[model samples]
Target: MSALATVHVVVPARNEERLIGRCLDALATSRALLLAERPTLAVRVTVVLDGCVDGTAAVVRRAPGVDAVHVTELSAGGARAAGVARARDLEPDLDRGRTWVACTDADSVVPAEWLVGQVLAAEQGAVCRVGAVHPELGPAERLLHLGWLARHSHAEGHPHVYGANLGFSLAAYEHVGGFAPLACGEDVDLVQRIRAAGLAVVSTGDDPVRTSARRSSRVRGGFADYLTALAVDLARAT
Candidate 1:
């Protein structure tokens, strides 16, 4: 079992003002739950407002106990990297091996057990833990949502890497040189690198994070875009 200590949550957002507040609210709940379970554990949440020309920063400012970092770039990978760096700056003495870094999107709402599950995974000797996500689709998009569920697996040992519900030890993150500056697919890239480094990556379906199912995406080739593509394919097959 690994000696766990602090847990840092990094959220990357771009023009997500409409949904970021809800995301922060969910994270606060998760943070509080984790703290209640482990009285001495430390949990930090940081939101990286990347190239936002909207009210995203305002929402983050109103959020208590949440740190906001503003940047002029639209890269999700870069924003995640910047957020983690800010976490390090705030706590200069964080133990790389004992500290956990969790990444999620501003359009996602994590469950109350999100942080607790990651901390438990770390305590069980996992260097990285990849969880699942369920998109919050509207009633009109019921067919699309059902199609997506039919094609995707929501079980343990599933082959899915989502930044919206991913966590890793700071030591393993540093060893892999952190997330690359990619506009999209950065989560998959980071997980691939971790696996190549012979690190133990645990995949679980427990407590999937709720994410936006909007067809329009802030970043190209992101989850929204993927869903849109799936919708198109489903239409063609009909």
Candidate 2:
């Protein structure tokens, strides 16, 4: 028999004032839904304001369900690492075997079942749950997003890394020494290490996160760049 574990969510943001409100709203809704399903489950959220010179902090501060809000100058990987540390510090009694760490972006909206799905995966012996992400975009970006989806679906193999929507048990995360301090590719790096260590990494295919499709993003080389590249390729093909 497996025991229910606490869920610690980390969101690292940089100048995401415009999207932070929506992100928090979606997360609060998801938390409510998760609590309804498992009244006794413990879920906490930490929003790290990475170099945010905007109202992102205020938004998180007023959010009803968030557990912590940290301000820092780091972006991408550094910000994420800080957020995870905040979660760890806030819960000093957290047991690696029973607690799970979940991560999402400031510009993304997750479904109500996001935490529930991750907890269930952990309880079932999965060390990590790599989830899917859908793009929220305009018409042009939507076309590119769909194209990417189709291309990925028919690609040679499935993706092994996705930071926007990812989760892992604390034990596995600690074993890999957590996210590195790079500005990009932290998600890929962490997952590669976990896989290299022979941890049980599974797919949370059903709960795809809704992430922004804007070309301008916090991370320099990320999904935004991929979409922009696809758009460029599309223009060249025309």
lDDT of 2 by residue, 1-238 (tens): 1575677889988878889788888888888888898888788888887767888778888888786556667747778888888766887887778878889998899998888788788878889888888778666466676677776552223574678889988888889999998878999999999999999888656678888878875567877888888888876876
User: How much does candidate 1 score in TM-score?
Assistant: 0.96
Range of the 10 consecutive residues with the lowest summed lDDT in candidate 1: 1-10
For all candidates in order, the CA lDDT equals 0.90, 0.80
Q: What root-mean-square deviation over C-alphas does model 1 reach?
A: 1.2
Clashes of each: 0, 0
Query: Can you tell me which runs of candidate 2 are displaced by over 4 Å?
Result: 154-157
TM-score of 2: 0.92
